[model samples]
Target: MEHQAIDELPSGKICPQKPPKNFVLLVSVLLLLTIVQLYHPSIFRSLFLSKTIDSNPQVPSTSSSSSSDHSNVQEDDLPSITSNLKCDIFTGEWVPNPEAPYYTNTTCWAIHEHQNCMKYGRPDAEFMKWKWKPDDCELPVFNPAQFLELVRGKSMAFVGDSVGRNQMQSLICLLSRVEYPIVVSSTEDQRFIRWKYTSYKFTLAAFWTPYLIKSKQVTYTEGPTKNGLFELYLDEFDEAWTTQIDEFDYIILSAGHWFFRSMVYYENQTISGCNYCLIDNVTDIGKQYAYRKAFRTAFKAINSLENFKGITYIRTFAPSHFENGMWNEGGNCLRTKPYRSNETRLEGLDLELYKIQIEEYRKGEREGRKKGLKYRLLDTTQAMLLRPDGHPSRYGHWPNENVTLYNDCVHWCLPGPIDTWSDFLLEMLKMEGMRSAEEKKLRITNDTTLN
Candidate 1:
């Protein structure tokens, strides 16, 4: 064909040319893609979207959907992890809780009249509202329902002095919010009291073993008759508790104040020495030595029980806030708030006794492990030391100017700082239960695989 040259169009004239088939198809495909992207953007995003690193080098780069899902998972898991983590519950500050004083002194029947600081007219109500907050993690509030479930079909005994009784009573009062336990057994002296939560088949008992060892009142009728002496049998277990030790699933033992009294020590039915007794030809051992020996003997006795499968807890010495004077010298805890860590100062004896108890607990734990028994130390010393205002002091007794009652700085007021002990105890129980459940699951999985 002969080639012909085409004429150029003018500036205002439009020139039209036939489009190629592939070009038309390409245009149609592009238009369809645009429409699809406008309607459903996710498919386009998957192909084109990219994650950018955060400006701060510390923050890691993450995909949008994946990061969102991860954040949700962490939010859900934070509480579970916090509750299960093994934290130092002893090291904490007292925070105010509006729904505190779990049970009022007037409402709780277990509270003794002497320990009812509120009923006796404590002017400051602020002390009852505070709660213990551990330094590392939040302490779970005392859950009565969970507590009952954990202790169901189990019996727990608090063995030691009145302070031990105080803790037991505090636990009873805390649990009473869920259900009122009936008095299963109580003597006229109330030395041995048992309460039963019938629905749960749980029993809580208090055994009054002031010394945690056999003690006898020795009468001295010779020459210059000194008042009777308290002869403590350091090597022997107090029959009051030993006879019933195997019956309990958990046992909490505490003793300190009773050791401060004038007492003589006996081992193997022989006189060892006397504490603060100035009898001629009798050795006058110091209080620290006697206390150490008594705790050693108590742990030894508990370790000797072959049939006891219960968990044992040695509650550390609860420091008394008898300030400016002795208990008999009109000393009292007059502060209305908890002391800061820097402000608190424990007595030499209090610290020494606490160390001694902790050492004995360690020893007991080592021995207990060998026998398949578990032992725990309830370190409540530092926590209680900060709460000088938690005591009943002059408020524990009825207001009477004529009656000269000693200020009770030794025992804590009901619904006071002592309630934190129960909180700590519940957390420990939960942790222990978690471990046990994990171990059981592991065993089941192993068995199933073998089958």
Candidate 2:
């Protein structure tokens, strides 16, 4: 100790380790800093390391009067329907069948209520007697031209099976009255087909998800509700369908036809593919359950993301029946005149499926609300179930006399009854108010989260 005489350490220099009275204090301070670095790295980073976090400045609050005034101004800014004429053609009653002017062989058809029931038949007629009768339950006739007014330049996608294609074609035809020319794509899937009218852009597309989940299109025929072998296509739901679709302002989906196909799958994995012809040992894979599960799956993906800000309108099931004997049995569709509006009726498993879908829809609404997602269902299934007279049966199929034209009631002719489905969609869009309600709903949802 004498020799070290405290080899006096220089100012600000570390002295040789000889337990000093304050050594424990120094160790304690070091240990506290180590704990801070381990537990609160950000604090250390901010103090020693150069780190910065960007933040937005606080926004000024608006007064209640200003908000009220803004709403009033918005109301004033809404486009007036002065130029729009109320067309009563949809409400016209069915006129008596016209005589076949020329010797021809075509059966005309029109949708009644919603079912594919027959109206009347004519042995000779160039045009089918299709009356645009409007009913109490029928949706109002919305002008497609008017709809495209605000939706111009926006992409609208209809995701589902063949029924979705029917909707696409119907929408395209409805908007044809406007000066715009429609460009339809060749392949189904996520192809681009456009309708250009002024500032509005209407893109009619088919995502071709038979089950809207993982159903495949195969060669074999399965029973009425279960058919088609599609194990190969069920792997990627988002990648196969949703990956390419984005920035959509409106989305319409329908997919009941595929449930009747041969096979259904949950993924690349097969669920079941029952034969359509034989009804024995049939699996209980109802379309309703499949649709609901898939719909919920879709909403979960949509709601989890912040960018999806659009209105999703789901068009319910479209009815199909060939059992009454396929136009030859008691089911004759050789009609030149449209059937009475109130005479339409629906039956069989189709009706049961329709009811189940409605229930699923209600469940979907609840799910969407809980997740801050906006999904609306267009209940056109009941409306379509009543329109049996609308089939092109015999009429659409038989272009020439003595030839059977409209035998199958599954598919609809162009500009036929399904056109009204598009009309319903347009009116629904309008009732939500002009300027795409989807955007408005999304805006409100986003604002709430931020505030």
Candidate 3:
């Protein structure tokens, strides 16, 4: 063989040199990849080109920038959807709203006869025309559609006294505007009533547990004389509500007036004490003490429930606007307008009870949050205390020719101030729903990033 450099070899006569096996394999692989790139452009782009484009961002066009800026400006102009929107729905003035009294007594059959103040002959209809306006921000009008959407496929219960029933009735009437719910369950005693909106799979029920504690009426008779005694089990929960707590997605509890009534308190089946039990050496613990203990027991039972992912609300005392005398002493709420917060001092048992309820709720809220339960205070006392004109007075019942009726200053009139309670509740629900949704979104994003 003639000695020759590899590059100077003749075209026809090649030097006896073998190509490296690895180098040949590499060239073959490159050729295959080039063919694939020409045949399947998407795969090639995804494997190489797309990553580079994503890594190096391009400047946005003027139109696109302007569009984004406009969207951002629009979002800024709108009210914040966050929970930080600070507005006191409770402490505000009532402004005239021509479209007030979302539902009328005649239109809503749910209204108890006594609450039908408009049907009977309430003179001042102007009281129903006002809407609550927070000093800091405007309250969104109660939208029945929105409320129903938020509570879709959920069950809610009002577990408290007749006042709770009153609130339930107001909510039903408000929701009735969107669609009438069917009464799914009704009993003779009417202690438990359930209304269902089949379209949304929503059930609204009211569980009448007046004291929020087990109670029984005992009668003692001695030779043709009979006396009725009210006995309350301070440590026990009312079965009417306790049995159903696990089924509810939301529960609202209220108790104040019932505690005011005389009762003997028992704990663990033994007499603990008494409120106004006139026996000697059985010291009369103030009604407030009993009230506090009763609420504590109720909260304990509620918080200890298993599989309860529900939110709870403790509605503060709804004050009676009796003036010059008490309920039995011919007192009446005759004003046709709301009281200015500065014009009056909120004192007496109503204010005291309200304060106590709020304090207890705070304690419950702290404890409940630990156990995955949420508790909030529906503080309606302050705003309601201002609306003395919303009471039923003598117009709560139809006129009777032969009988005289005492004025009703305790329960509020339907199609009146009680409707505002629904407004406050709906707003709270909206804010809470927004916060919960935000939390869920954040949790999902974090989980995705981890994956």
User: Which candidate wins on lDDT?
Assistant: 1
Models 1 onward score TM values of 0.76, 0.57, 0.76
Which is better, 1 or 3, measured by lDDT? 1
Error of 1 at 95 (Å): 1.6
The residue ranges of model 3 lying beyond 4 angstroms of the native Cα positions read 1-84, 220-228, 401-405, 437-451
The candidate 1 region of ten consecutive residues with least summed lDDT is: 65-74
Model 3, position 443: C-alpha lDDT score = 53
Better TM-score candidate (2, 3) = 3
- Count clashing residue pairs in model 3: 0
What lDDT tens digits, residue by residue, belong to model 3 across residues 1-451? 2334334666797667657989768877897788767755334533442243233333111110100000001121121232124545576787887767667778888888777887888877898888877776566656665567668899999988888898998888877766779888857567888889997899998888888888986654321112445788888878777877798899988987777666777888988777776655566676887788778878888888888889887888888888888776778878999888787767877777777777777777667756867776677887888889988888877667322336887777888888887777766675664444544565577679999
What lDDT does each candidate get?
0.74, 0.48, 0.72
